[model samples]
Target: MESKGILTKLYSFLYIRGFKVWTSYRTQVALTILSWVLPVFTYYFVGTSLGNSLVERIGVKDYTSFFVIGLAFQGYVSSIITTVSGRIRNEQLYGTIEYYVLSRSGVTSFLFYSAIWGFAVNTINAFIIMSVGLGLGIKYDINWLSSIIISVLLILSTLGLSFLSAAFTMVIKQGNPISLFFSTFTTLLGGVVFPVTAMPIPLTYLSYALPLTWALQGLRGSFLDGEGIVQEGGIILVLLVFNVILIPIGVLAYKYAFRKAREKGTLSEY
Candidate 1:
């Protein structure tokens, strides 16, 4: 009974913390929604420009639907993964690092809770944007279950990569370069503008190793190709395997970095 109570309190705290963070900045939330709206318009124009050309290249019956789905999935992947690594820098600047370390709580659990909040906001954002796309007659067959699965795998990959970034931030006491490097590398290599297969062979090989490549492919394939998520079961399984392999390694690396920071007496420095 005592254990149950503790678990209940933890879950409640998680939800409350997420909500508090989300609601604390009403202006930012509004701006985020507004900013997302602009992209729908941009994509509509671009898809219109592509005209019949996109059909020959993208292989989708409806270029509008494909473009919208791609944009939505990209938003999902970017928002989900970027939050964790980005948190490290923000927390450091705001003097929240020591608070996180000295709270008599594990960092991993707290990170997971914080991600749930980010995920919630982004999911709502995606829905709103996609609804507008639907209004523009951009409709495609999608499997919610497969999307959830892809989301789970993407989150795991994001957590691992974020932990890696957090470790770098903690050790170096800097964030800009590492953050920019990862964001840029993934954005270009992970098919944000177009398909990975369109890249040269050498770059295509590198794309295979990128976690976003598979996650985005899985999401886009489902909606644009009229394929079910389960149809891409092999890739999904590979993502799950990658996550299982990386989590322990990430935790261990973070633990080592944390210990090093404490020993160097630089744990509190931003």
Candidate 2:
């Protein structure tokens, strides 16, 4: 009961803090919405220009819809890494990280709640982006149940990467190259703008190593092909395996990095 009470307070603190931060930057919020929406027009035009050839190559009936789904999922993936890492860096820069380390609620709890807030905000952003795409006439035959299942798995897999990024932020202090590299790598290789099959053999094999590859395949299967969880069983299994393997490794890495940073007297350094 005491533990549950602690969790409740921690959650309330994180949620209120997130709400305050978002509301304080109304103009930035509007620009962020515009940034997400504006890219769809460029993709829509490019997809239309390519016509049926693009559809045939991608094995999807509508290139615009395919691209839109990929882009939406990319938003979720990017947010997890960038938000977790960036929040830690921001706390360090603001000299509040030491307080986090000393907090009764615990640093890990703070990190986890911050990540949850980021995931919630980005999920809403993805939905808005998809709605805008639909308004632009990007058609989808969505399987809501399957999409939800795939989304949960995607979030779980992504949390592993998020934790890894947080670990790097602890050690590096600033300029998280791992986050940047993963963002670009996933964009190119996770079939965000194009199909992974179009890549060379080596690149195709390499793409399979990233959890986002299976996530995109599962998402596209549900969104574009109307596939269910049963139909996407293989991709789901792969993602499950990734979550099981990566999450523990990521947590241990973060804990080790945090400890090293403290011992080196670098945790509060910026």
Candidate 3:
């Protein structure tokens, strides 16, 4: 009876959908893992071919480390939108969204919890990419305090954006402007593959407006330039301003949108 009860609890509580797919197709899992590292080499070769001018333009000598940090960190920024919105999207299609919306803890926590695995996968992907960069001679001079501060700010900004995107998804059911904006422009303007300095001065102003751009600048400064939190105080301030403004706006939008959806009886509509 004890063994049967334990097995029943495991079956009830464990989510095996994504895991089952990976287990059934080991090759796909391996390739998906390998794909994360491949970009490090692509960027390295591109950086090498571009030569010293590339490094000089970015004002960072180590091209590998610069792009590596940019790429790894942007995953968290970009993934927050897709993951949270994707959960709501999936629930809508599965017709299980009504249950989530009616749950005591509600749709906000429901979507947040369901989307966590994607962030975990993003974390693993980041670790693998950074490890590959290390193998390719990218060096770090990390200041733990600065990294932690910048990371927390980045996460807060991401959560704010996540809620905003989720709010849009709940209503629109497709092609949210918030998600579209981030998806289309974040890689180009967020300093993921290149410094904002490399862009035209007007575009540089736009880049500075992005939370990812500030976060990456501070993160790279901490990891590569051994910058302390005090050294990156300006970046920290900008991120705090973003958190303060965006978080409340996001929460308000989420509550309003979710309430609108419920009122319209559109919970399961795709």
Candidate 4:
């Protein structure tokens, strides 16, 4: 099938990138260990201080465990966004993006492969952190079915956001600001470190509108309550709806920007 061929290409791209990242074995392992344990120390102390008072308010039985799962998932989702948006600039500077874009490969194929590479790398990081948490006795819901479904939805939503940022890069010729905006917004409004429901009404509304809000909620649901997936089905549904609408818009915007860039002959300019 044509779809299968595309996926094969995507998978090969991811495999190559992952192999390269893994070649830095010592650094990768050390950083992965730090990622897992350092956060536990920070959140465990904070959560213990809040104790049952905050745990109950946040609708989770164990605040520390809840925080750890949410943080791990947030790390993965945020890393995907960060890498996809920033990779274009890196490749452009390195003289690879122009080659890829102008090659026989379709732009769609190139973008998909780049995103697959990012997703693969970040997924490894997420797994290392989560496995360490489990070794430390952080009980996970382990609903693979729900986790898979939510993961697909999260990737779709995030890929749409990635496209928007790529379009910004294609049009404006830089993506650092777009990356900064999403990173800051995710930390503030994504409910990774704290519950968004605790925020005031206005901020709560704003948080709900952000894509990462839905992502964190779905991830927390998948890993923490297990019931959160079914109970917060509305959020998941909304995210699905958002992907359906935004992905097409993002694609059109990206194509338009790409055409403009080609016309201006600015694709190679840093």
The model with the greatest lDDT is 2
Best by TM-score: 2
Residue 35, candidate 3: Cα error in Å is 3.2
Q: State the lDDT of candidate 4 residue by residue for 1-270, as single tens digits.
A: 888886777656766565556566878767766865688778777777877876788666766666666666666556666776667667667867777776767665677667776677667667776776677678777666667777778777777777777877766766356566665667667777778887888998998887677766777767766754577678778878978987888788778877888799887667
| Local error of candidate 1 at residue 262 (angstroms) | 1.0
In candidate 2 the C-alpha lDDT for residue 240 amounts to: 88
TM-score per candidate: 0.84, 0.93, 0.88, 0.86
Query: Which lDDT values do the candidates have, in the order given?
Result: 0.70, 0.83, 0.82, 0.71
> Whose TM-score is higher: candidate 2's or candidate 3's?
2
TM-score of 1: 0.84
Model 4 gets an lDDT of 0.71
The list of candidate 1 runs beyond 4 A from truth reads 1-16, 58-61, 176-178, 224-226
Q: Write the per-residue lDDT of candidate 2 for residues 129-226, one digit (tens) a residue.
A: 78988898867788989899889988887888888899999998777876897767788988887888989989989988988888888898898778
lDDT of 3 by residue, 1-270 (tens): 877864543443234644455458889878978777787889899989989875777676778888999888888877777778887898899999888767665777665554454566677778888888888888889999999899889878888888899899989999888887776689899998888898999999999888999999999999888999789999999999999988898889999999998899886899
- Model 3 lDDT-worst window of ten: 9-18
Candidate no. 4 TM-score: 0.86
What TM value does model 3 have?
0.88
